[model samples]
Target: MLRTLLLGLVTLAASLVAPAAAAEPVAEPGAATTQNPISSSFSDTYADPAVLRGKDGWWYMYATSDPLHEAPSEFGLMHIARTRDFADWEYLGTVFDEADRPAWTTGSSFYWAPDIRYVDGRYVMYYTVTDTVAEPGPWNFAIGVVTAPTPAGPWTDSGGPVVAPRPTGNGDYFNTIDPALLAAPDGKRYLYFGGFHGGLWVTELDESGLRAVGSPTQVAIGDRYEGSFVVERDGWYYLTASSANCCAGPVTGYSVYAGRSKSPLGPFVDHEGVSLLDSRVGGTQVLAQNGNRWIGVGHHAIVSDVSGQDFIVYHAIDRNDAWLDAPGGVNERPTLIDRLDWIDGWPVARAGAGPSDTPQPAPTTSSSLGIVSDDPAAGEALRAVAGSWDAGTDDDGDAGAVGRLVPADGADDAAVRTEASAPREPRVEADVRVPTGGRVAVEVADSGPSGVSVTVDDAARTLTVEATLGPRTVSDTAPLPSRFDAGEWTSLAVEVRTGRATARLAESRLGDADAVVGVDLPNGLARPRPIQLTVSGGEAQVDNLTVVAAHQPVTERVAEPVPGDEVFAEEFDGDLDTGWSWLRPSSSVTVGEGVLRWPLESVDVVGAANTGPLLLRTPPEGDWMAETKLDLDLGSGTVRNYQQAGMIVRVDDDNLLRLGDVAIWGTRQVEFGKELDENGALRWGAHLGGPVAETMWLRIMHTIDPATGEHRYRSASSRDGVSWRWGATWTLPAHTEPSIGLYAGGGATPATVAAFDWFRLYEVR
Candidate 1:
């Protein structure tokens, strides 16, 4: 009751001083942030974002480090960039990109997605690294850490992984990547990680915060969720994770999903009351490709500015780059920033054509002194210190609002204090004036089973660290280093450690410790906790107080493994082939012995663009050689440009390579071309002369060049299934997968037929 009433006073005072009007938003603030992509580098391929605003007035961006085709250990450990305004940026190259990599970190590639926190004046980062992605059962990821004096390295890797996958690998734990750290209300640091196969999970970190202290709890298992960051606001923990395949160029299905929970390790459900354990469903859609060319955009970081407005920074693929289809352009995901809206208790990001091309509000820059001279700060509420305390003027000429203890009669022990919202590694200092017989103390209590109180007793001329956390209360005291002249103000501070407290009091700023004393409170007080200020004995006044926490960055996210692949073959028999399946809906297919007949309706191999009859199979290892005999039945109609059927190498509806018989501009010929987009616009390779007959043998060969490493595809036409005439050779995008099948599409007739005598696939020598 005392704590409640004492806190009420601070709340009331803060409320009175706060702004009364709704302030203008930063969005179109005549002086808003900058443009889309926020970057102009032709080589800016950023992903797996990690962001931090330093004291230096600049925001630094870090993400999954890419080696950019360089040899291992070539680029830095992680990609780094910086900007004063969110618009233009300067890429700072990589961090930890040393000569031989670090001996402590064992990985075959660049450090994957990483997140960083500023703890104890240094930046600590968590990242994933691994040796090889060969087997499923073997643990695939090892999350490591590195510390630096600044956000921009010279980072010294701890030389060890803090979170590693279970040695048993992909079973009870399908993944041990994408870690999100949080400092919860329980006064503990927690780490959240995992995805799809095993479900997302959470675990507690020890005080050092370099390793896990407990078993992990599974939180959610969506259809496919990864790359998540968790943020805490108003007692609720919000998790924003990416769902679906996020890397496929223009046709990617990646979107952001959100869910909230009362506890960090949650039985979290979405806005619909559905459990996170469910499959493929969104907790709540945070953002998606609502159209206009922004492709796959996921992996985000949420940053709250000093003015208290929240902004999200992430990576989104630009359609302009998506159209490149070769080299680094196809997947050149650039960083994006935009303001976030909080409606009710949740966050909503309204991005029209998100990964939006329009300019967004810049993060309201935080003042160096933390005072928002403009208007009331959203969360900078002045808290009332609880207990039986009265407001009064101090003997020292100070008059605004000073707390005075009101004891019961002459019994003393009365106090006034506020608490840190959660259990955090804390350090607090304050200037205080103690009456002749008084004591001013700061107490860190669990409020239930344990607590510690560090007091500066002027009457006793000593400093005491009294803690009651473990099984009993113990006192550790030290004589005053020098006279803290009574009647005048003195500076005192207390530092909270794992189950212990250290108090320092002196006449002036204690340059170095003359004496150090401490006592263990309780074993359970392992987490540095919220501390309270209390005054006992004579009147005591506390002012110019400051508090600091060491674990602020644990709330950031991230992970990736060598994606698993499905490889095998399919041979059509009397029954439907197992490996071969129709993609969505298109022409009808009837399978029989040595034959698969495609009856076209108003359909094409490329659903919206390329003209071809659709059929598909999983690409197995080694080179692929597909040969087939086709009898094209174009019906009695004038065949047009796309009127042809042959071999289809499809990546998706938007991209594919169709080569074979094609009617180009009123001419009938076996044309080799690539339908680069769903628009049916083909990058014509060449016209392989005119067609011989309706029945011809066709073969498409796909192989990876050992030298240049580019995928090579060749098409050949044959008569009598023996003598062959080869067509032009073509190259497909280096970063996509293709499934081979016989296809037919054209503007000639609504109805067409493609009959195959036999479709054979082989592993090329």
Candidate 2:
């Protein structure tokens, strides 16, 4: 009651400050702050953050529903806050009160992931309704909208869902939540929504901005992306989404990734040309925890300062103080702000520096920033080689000039070559229509005899990358999404960097796609060469054809195993050691021949059951690392509703971390899972990594956050035991002795045994 009263007083005080009539033409920039987490003015968890510059000149921020403080009765109904400078914020309570929530929403329903936008002269906010009064269970998620005269006001709910609860082709329904609005320049409004259950999708909204109008198009694949946000820069549409687990107490691996396309609705692809829908999954990392005080950096909003510099406003967990009160309680994610930079046509948080922990300059608040292009225009420094190519106007009904190349009666290829030498690492792009039955090709890093050629077969709707050596040619083909229309102007691109070449076919003028489908070339280009564009068998008009130096390689950095002193080792050659204990002892587990064989169980430790037995053992006195070699193969490309076996670190059934090679759906992955109790409810969070082998090595490194003495554990796995893949880290409470162990389960699969070669613990170096 005290907390509620304090919040009411604060809201009333904030309301006294009148809105600015108009933004200043040249506003003064805010003073630099000493460090990040610019929203540190507020101490509560503010997850799934969204920011909108109000007409009154202040930037209003909204977050998912949660209690403002430790008081359970003081829940916030989608909290709201505002700020003049991006650093210090003023909490203005929440958007809804107990009596003002949507009528369709039940008392237990939680509002989440709010997206605020001003369209058609009014403020429109779209949010997620976790469960409605009419429908319940299995995640009956829907998108709800509300409108108000101003950023803060007496808003009116639209009465019902803009996006009704939807079902996937499978028996289960899609997790339709996380709605983001993009008020396009062409008087069209597109809403990007959905979550881990249904993937990310985009649908056009009616003029009223309250209902969906057209069929929705899937953007990112399920189990990979959520919290979809779209922003346009230099004519390219970037789709940024959060990945991994959002809530796992201290172990949440939530991070942000991005992909871009030319069209508002697209077949978006990452920097390496990987499609978001591909099973291998593709995302250029935007923000991630870089071994700092912060973790789970994701679900962000991008805003700009008056000076045009961009800033990413998101939430992150401080390793030292990860939870509200109890170890397994609600995660304490606070809003943070950092500079967002664009590198070579791609957006990276802090110029790929990851999260910040030091003093930084703040954003200027007086005006608005717009997108600016740094890339040079295309079709320059090029000359026709095979056919008479002439400059033409608007070939495909679009308002733009195009280079038209019509091959003669029997000509095979109408080619154009760049007069200037191409860079050693070059990216070539062209916007051209696929002649009814012919093909369009872009060749990069080409010498006289050898080069990489990317061809798009319009008839087959396939993108192929072929490497040509004196007499040898290697190629790989991937089918394009049906949305890539041959009748429309398609953007084709090929980027050659390092030792591989990537080919992409975009619905826009040019872009990237599925990285897994890209092909490896021979030693890259030894010398500078010329790029070429070819049209075969028919006449095609090309626009925006350019070749420029590609950016430095963008790849995932594998975590190196920390060296330490050996403390404990179990070979499994003898009967159970006295150090090991089991939560629910199972007779199916055996020990012999230097191995421990545990058959997959039909139990789980998540949710309410908590019945899966875990083999338990304590570690050394201080920070330590645990290593284990497991020979468990759940098979490849098969549905095994999950059979897994690996190492685990636990404080109990409710709060623990598990890393195992498990088969989920059709994908075999290395899963890092966290199970915790949130406000008396079981909450499970997980993130996945891949390339599992029949025999693999898994390790967990544990340390303590010096500031708060919280226990931190990081996960790593290796297919060959030589190179390790480090995953996100999770945390435990201070001074607590959580046991480290091994377990395997997640029913519905054929019998399989998890063979353990050894278990070892070592003191931190």
Candidate 3:
């Protein structure tokens, strides 16, 4: 799967005369700078990228380039870029050129697969520079080693290929390329490398890291693969590699696959126990074509940040922006970066999809949350659609300011539309403030069969639903109590449900009131229409205005649930009774007071698709019942949305049963049902929520109707941690098999404490 990388067209006319480019500019989180292929002023053609943060604090990135790129005959082979932040990058120069070629090999033109290592005092780089065209297929390339005092090298080569291609045991095939090294628990270094038509090879290397000690051991897999990268986490060795045609522009079917082994070498299999060699069968798919806008997504490097969060840096040819069609870009391999989360025993990016278009959490370089400014122009959340806003200002009026909207005497400039919300209705929210006689109102057009315009005006304290041009059939009105306070901020929201509309207002979460009326917006305005805001005079400042498809309001009451026939149950006396295994370790997990005390991190179990949580697994499945009583103690921090912990049923990472608290700002809501990340790297679930209790009994039941061969899942919770009242049951897609587990997570402040009294599993008798 070797194809030419696109980034080698430009060569600085100046060689060793000047050092590679360097700089220090950082972009705030969620800024456009974090977008895929990120921002690089240096090179658009960068590919086969290998990034390392140098001792100087600048991230130095090296990559392969077309040997044809015009440069000094003595110029280095790999292209380089350096940056203080990951977003803005400055292009550096080559690592080696023709004049710096290894002695054993004649002058070479082709160079790719560059890897860097900073050990002891000097820097070591292993790269593929061998011209294998003279040999047969199955990739007959070898790697060479070079050393220099710094990542920005004034180099010296090992004089020859440190690892070269040789005949296999069958004496028929051989492979040698894409070298990567692992510094194992032992004092020795293990070199991992290979390519298409060749099995991955792992060999022991001396501390020098340039020479192999003995013959290499070929790691077993099903088929040919390349770009071998091995990393060890939690005593597990994960080998990730790229397979198939990695480059061919839009049609390229390249993808990344991974498998884990206790030992660094030898056999590795996917979740299905199928050999990675048989990728067609299964091999923990890491990233595949996102299909929305990106393609040819493969040949990646997995590296971790200071926060221990992993990132997958790779090159992909954009569908609309392919480099081959661009000037001087004969190949179109553009580099991209995405966060990678280790789930179960494998790594998964957003939805296991190749590259996501959805905005991701800002790159986690540090453990703390990176907060961007709230100024509308600088705010990341409000970047989608800048409603007709002229300018903004604050007390300083220097820069960071909220967007100011003023209605013209007679013009449509005061209103603008954004993405429309659906299913039930749109959740429109924004933090607004008015001076003296000013007002801000939001209006949505409903083009549905039975729709009308719904407007909420705080200044007038009026909640109105009217039909602009219709038979004037549906209508309703409600008074907003103390809706607006001059010169003060207001949290405004409108939940437009079919046949009914509810408007909620609050200064904070406290002192909140809702105004509900049986009035529907014109169904004819099915799409997002300009939110009509009419200002007679005065001016208003708007900020934190966000529009999302919010969950429906919960209206369930606490009560004892009806119990079903019992099957099997566990009441902990001392330790975790046999069947339970700690799938993931936490800081402290102890059993006492007839409970399993679990303190979850600030991360929660959102859509059960991308696995990560404090999970305790049990081997039980099918038409079964798993019930547990959980008592959540705030410890030091309060629960927030995507926080709180509870019981879950799992088949794997992508498909699972989750029954837990989905909180926002310490307000608790219980969400129950099967959750999956099947929709555009986002969680797509058909679930419902109810009030949450600190001490509640959670139950998940999977049932089957033997006659019709139908399977369904039901969930319920009780305030007493005993009896539970079940909700509407939902059937999962056919092949879903679920195992029971207890999960607690909330990657946030103060941490979380959840203690489980006992867990019991039962099958209908």
RMSD values, in order shown: 21.3, 13.6, 24.4
Error of 1 at 572 (Å): 33
Every candidate's lDDT: 0.55, 0.70, 0.55
lDDT of model 2 at position 228: 82
Ranking of all predicted structures according to lDDT, beginning with the best and ending with the worst: 2, 1, 3
TM-scores for all candidates: the values are 0.49, 0.58, 0.44
> Any runs in candidate 3 off by more than 4 Å, and if so which?
4-33, 67-76, 132-140, 167-173, 277-281, 323-329, 351-353, 358-361, 364-765
Single out the weakest 10-residue window by summed lDDT for candidate 3: 12-21
lDDT leader: 2
**Candidate 1, 718: how far from true, in Å?**
52
Quote the positional error of residue 201 for candidate 3 in Å.
0.9
